[model samples]
Target: MPQNKQIHLDNRPTGEAELSNFKLVVGETPALADDQVLVRHHYLSLDPYMRGRMNDSKSYAASQPLGQTFQGGTVGEVVESRHPKFAVGDKVVGFGGWQEYGVVDANQPGVLRKVDTTHVPLSHYLGAVGMPGVTAWYGLVKIIAPKAGETLVVTAASGAVGSAFGALAKARGCRVVGIAGGPDKCKYVTDELGFDACIDYRQHPDVKSMSAALKEACPDGIDGYFENVGGYILDAVLLRLNAFARIALCGMIAGYDGQPLPIQNPTLLLINRVKLEGFIVSEHMEVWPEALKELGTLVATGKLRPRESIAEGIEKAPEAFLGLLKGKNFGKQLVKLV
Candidate 1:
């Protein structure tokens, strides 16, 4: 029997995630069943959506039960396997939670994908060339379908999905304006990601004034809105949407810790003839290969930059997740385990 380090939900967070909310412990690694594999986790992904899982409420997936390890995306190597597709020393990615060793059932949705890491960093399978990249591509091309010369706006522009959205839109000859939290993120969005303009939401407190600034940046009005933070900024964008505008509803990190604040400008959606649609990446796996392939080329050619903020050790997993929620991470937040 092997002892593994795991983080479990000690208590539900009241607002911002606290370090005490997670319990780190050493537990016995379970024996693998027939047709199962024992995976040793290398890296754990800390995504915003995981915040929703911390709460005991109805969602796409159930919240983590108290005393159970929190669920997440992980990249690891197979140590033992009863499955033919996976063998010892196979490098793969899966939903292995925040743990050092995982006994993965081969048939589950979070099963690992074996890959060759010689061409790219293994961490990327959790970021730009993986879920976030695929989510951005699917949301933009499939949902919004922006035309050339149209204006596209994305909030949380420095994040993995936001940067991907901006880069893809710019590639298609659409004008891109990004709304980021601060001056640093604003600079990164406009200078590094090649967006036409960026608005620092923190510097500008008034949404009405920010809306004016956005209108100045986009004189023709926004044709597509890629919403990552849904709150006042969303309400402001609503007032400036062009007729027949499309909104690709992604994660709402602004209200993730609490109940959603009522939008004051939802009527603007009807007044501007805007269409709003929400999406999850699971429904678009068929298009993932194409997105990853194209994103890989861009990354290899240095056209697209994938930024990662990594925390070392499985003990630091909870801190990394909390940082991601507080917008402390510059890009994708990941934890490196044994």
Candidate 2:
């Protein structure tokens, strides 16, 4: 029998998640029952939203149970199957958690689906052409709803979702500006991702400084904003918002470390008549098909390029995840489990 390696949640983190909060165990793989398929994970996606699930407080999703396998999205291949829909060697993507192998029931809805990796890379499914890509689509197409000649500002611009949003917005004829942490990411956002401009938020440590920089970059004001890293970035963007602007509130990574960072200028929302709304991507699954189609095409055609920060083994998942929360990893953070 093959040994299956799994990481479990050992403790609820009070602040930043540490290695001690997780426990790894190796065990014999269970036998497959009827309509079951055994998948060996090739890559595991580490995302910012997983941080919210670690807390015991109420969230969009249920709190992860202690001792249970830590939840994550995985791209894998079927190694064995008793199900008619899946066959051996088929590539698949699913919520397989932090495990080397996953047993998926064929009858279950929204669990597993075979993916074609011929045109696009298998790992891309976990990032640009997958959930993160769909997340960018939902926020841009559905919420912000930018028109041609408008200005769109995205926070965490070099990240998977933010990069996709910038590329997609630019493709639609919008002037794109990205706010990232450093010079390198800002360069990638403009040079590689083709944004109109990028602001290095590290240089401007305070809201006042950032707002000045934002004011210069967005001379016409921000018509739409895709917020990823909130706190002061949101404050800075709020000050630059055009009348009746739309803001798609995504992950607030700044406040994820147990700090309650409130917006200093909530009045801007009312004064600017900004349509500010927070959204959880999983809650809106109806757009997945359409979003994936466009994202996949853009990626396959070299239009929507997404970068990756890959860690080599399943054992490195905890470290990679911790690094992601701290913005230590660039682009999409993934663990190569195969």
User: Candidates' TM-scores?
Assistant: 0.95, 0.99
Could you say which candidate leads in TM-score?
2
Model 2 residue 331 CA deviation (Å) reads: 0.8
Top model number, lDDT: 2
Worst 10 residues of 2 by lDDT: 252-261
Each prediction's RMSD over C-alphas, in Å, is 1.7, 0.8
Q: Scored by CA lDDT, what does every candidate get?
A: 0.86, 0.92
Clashing residue pairs found in predicted model 1: none
lDDT of 1 by residue, 1-338 (tens): 57999999999999777999999989898888887999888889999998988888787667888998888889989999988888899999888888999988887754678867877678888887788988889989998999999999998888888888888888899999998888888898888888999998887667788888888989999999999888888888888899999999988888888777678878888888888999999777789779988777766777778788899998888888888887889878899876
Query: What is the TM-score of candidate 2?
Result: 0.99
Residue 28, candidate 2: C-alpha displacement in angstroms: 1.6
In model 2, where do residues sit more than 4 Å from their true spots?
Answer: none
lDDT per residue for candidate 2 within 140-209, as digits (tens), equals: 9999998999999998889999989987998899999999888899999998999999999889989999
Residue 59, model 2, lDDT: 74
